[model samples]
Target chain A: MNVVDLIKSYGSKTVVKEVSFTVPKGKVLSLIGPNGAGKSTVMGMISRLIARDAGVIDFEGQDLTKWKSKELAKHLAILTQHNNVQMKLTVRELVAFGRFPYSGSRLTPEDNEMVDKAIAYMELQEYQDQYIDELSGGQRQRAYIAMVIAQDTEYVLLDEPTNNLDIYHATNLMRIARRLCDELGKTVILVLHEINYAAFYSDYICAFKNGRIAKFGPVEEVITKETLSEIYKVDFEIMNIGGKPLTIYY
Target chain B: MNRAKMHRRNVTRLALLAVMVLVAVVFYLLVNSHPEKPKLFQYILSLRLPTLLCMIIACISIGAATLIFQSIVNNRIVTPALLGMNSIYSFLHTAAVFVLGTGSTLFLNANLAFAVDLLTMGVVGTLIYWYLFKKTGHNVLYIMLIGTVLSSLFGSVQSAMIRVMDPNEYDALLGSLVADFNNINGEIILFATIMLLVLAFVLRRELGLLDVITMGRNQAINLGVDYDNVIRKLLFGVVLCMAVATATIGPVSFLGLIVANMSRQIFKTYKHSHLMVGASLMGMLALIGGQMISQHLFHFTVPVSTFVTIAGGIYFLYLLLFKKGAY
Candidate 1:
């Protein structure tokens, strides 16, 4: 659960330079940064979506790079920025895709159990049979999340999970992300633009600035007014509401 | 959207395929009895069997391959031809005739020339997949534009070569490309049939993979499917199938589009296995039906391709006008 010195460069330019951090098991790590700060790039490298120029990721004291893709997929799942599926699959069918890592294409009895559990976990049982395109943005997002949850991976990486979601669904998504770690004991690593959501829900924050990790610590240490102002280049006031830190930046 | 629905569609498709194969078999029997240059039945047999085989080969393979290509590209408008595969094939043919003289076009080693055509088309097909998909990361439009330009350039070069050829060879060259199935050699038909079967066997593993591929890259990769490998293999498979179809019966313009669109409407599922199996049957049905009517009903020796154009043309127009059809 520790990443040792990860670096990613994009052809004569380093999009994610020499970044390193660690995520303990059963904890949430939110990556926050301004646009084009390589937050997504780091997530891509960790999830093997984008190749790293130089890095070593030691998860459970094993080199992540050396792990077989199938094995890695079984332990980790990623929901990317755009889920432009080519098929008009139903929510249940889409969720079933998450089980592909456990077995090959054929879903096993165990896979079925996980798929059903994920569907229930996401509160999507009502819309399970509905076509994904026919669903509202929030419902579709939940379905996509359900698919990742069905992967049953130890860690789940999501990029801009709230892109098209309204506040109600966005908050629902953050709450579910926290519940995955607290109740299910899964590490949730996310790249999100919503600083307040990150501050409120995250146990730890890993802020990236210019392809580098600016700070990596508990939420209390990372979401301070000065740190928020530096990372986002915007003035912010940290207000604690119901004992949870909220960074109000306008 | 419905599991039962997909299964039902599959069953219906299988039944239709069975019926088409039975009809094709009956027609094959009828055509076999006719002889090469003799009385009505004998003359009919010689002409019809080749025509039957050629139509069957082009229709089924082109339809199936085009459906697969469209699935992988995630665009309904794209066909194997849009990849400039036919251009690579026809260009090679034109070049062979230009340099080797029209005599070389009919070389003693027909197998060698066929192999050359297949290999060249295969390479071009692979390159098209590699360049647009893997190398440049370009979209479908860029790929199509590049392919269209290349095809036009090759077509012009081919035409220029044809213009300069001696009038006597020109007649022979033009005649060869005209695709009168009666002129088909048994050996060529046999070769094409075997190739199709072999391709089917090889692509069996990829049939399911195509379904996941349409889900796009992130989901495919997250599911531990090697997206790049599967795409390359499938695209290559389409090229092989397309080359066989074209080399066997010249280019049947837009046959893939016709079959794919028809199958999508009928099946309503995005699985490649279903689409391919369904389209292959639809293609054979189209070909076989066209042949039967042309021989027994129309009473004219019209090419099967011509009949397909009428059907395909109408379907194409419907698809264009139907806004929801884009999905």
Candidate 2:
């Protein structure tokens, strides 16, 4: 999809301004920025979970606004920032909601299998019946991710999937995001605060500053000390460990 | 879902439904055997059948309606009572007398009163949901405030009318103020039953959407469900069903909270199909059981309204506590 200068405002207060980027069809693009840097806002607008005040989003060389919402949902799925689901559903039942576009109310056997697979993929096999509200923080976040992953879309947009998760589960989540691109050929776009994880697991890093793209390209280009210092305003030392750049700013 | 567990849950759900129906039917039989009700199906059908039908319909409709409503509101502790539907109902009855004068109210037909109440409340509810949620950028607080204000205005008008009416007529109106099976709207009962069944069926397709919705509106919309459209559709069904039930049974406000809470505890899931059916059955059981106690045991000739309110009131307190502690 090609996006040109995307901007979103809430009652005249601009949240995301003149953001421009192009997401390749089969790449993992990670957006790493400080909190309230319009990362989630950009994600929301791109996924059409919220409206944009300015800019154009084109999918498959067509305008995004022209596409019907259901059609858009088929192509892209979003795991939003607000992950508090008030429903008392189990992991499996919650995951089944991903197939709502294809299967309205009734759960066909095939849909059932997909839900099972999504649960298993999240490594939540044993806790499928456990109430999601009763699950641990990491487990619940994985459960939400599993639901979006089960949507079976070409592009998956996640806002802070690692939020509220422990180190192990957080790494596990980024690894899964990588696998979505490498194995399943689905384009994964995520907003993560931890820059090192983005540099480690992502094919590309898209940097945003004050609501616009500071830099957008390969991980090698975006993770450099010059760009990192420019974006974060912190003195950073970059080290290449296992061929991937790692930034340390204390 | 595994075959074994799925079968087990289905069996348990079926058993629960059967028990609820049994409670309703058995109590209904006892209530029908009263001195005022004649023997034989057709003879008893006049007074008791209508009462049975109205009670069952009101109980089920409001019960299931509140289940969906609470899910939409995303708070199990809040029911339609929080929406101020009940107080709005009393306001309508009292205002009609005060505004149109005693002559018109005295000559007013029972069915007509119910019809007017249903129509006016229906319009108000639709307007409230639309204006607050749709036009003003989906604000729930605005909706609640408007409803509360309208409820208070209606209540004050009704109270003033009561002070002016003849003491005997005032007593009669007050007596009918609280719902009882004795003063059943038989014609509207059939209408309500048909409306309940139809809405329930239509809402059945909406159950899965509701399950998705209970995940919260933003998540539901992200998953491809048209969140606003779906909410409007469900709320319309909710308003219609609640209005008919309330008008028919004379406002058993908190009955819904009790039944919805009971169902959730028994079967722990957010699936609307299970929640709706379960709550409806439980409501029927509670209504029937309460009526049985009032008739056979107390012989108090008192309306079953107090039992529903008191029981539901106590249950509401328990739910508030549950929300405070329970996850």
Local distance difference test, each candidate: 0.78, 0.77
What value does the lDDT take at residue B16 in candidate 2? 68
In model 1, what lDDT does residue A130 have?
85
Model 1 lDDT per residue over A67-153, tens place? 777778888999987876655678888898887767656788988899999999999988988888888888889998899889888
Off-target runs (Cα >4 Å) in candidate 2 are B1-4, B31-45, B92-113, B130-154, B157-181, B201-204, B323-327
Compared with the true structure, what per-residue lDDT tens digits does model 1 show for residues B170-209?
7866655444444543446777788788878887777667
The residue-by-residue lDDT of candidate 2 on A1-250, one tens digit each, is: 9989888877767778888888978999999887678988888888877778889999887888887767777788888666766556778777888887777657799988888888888888898878788898888888877887778899988888887778998998888899888988999999999999999998888998887788989999999989999989999999999999998899
lDDT of 1: 0.78
A135: Cα error in model 1, Å: 1.6
Report, to 2 decimal places, the DockQ of model 2.
0.54
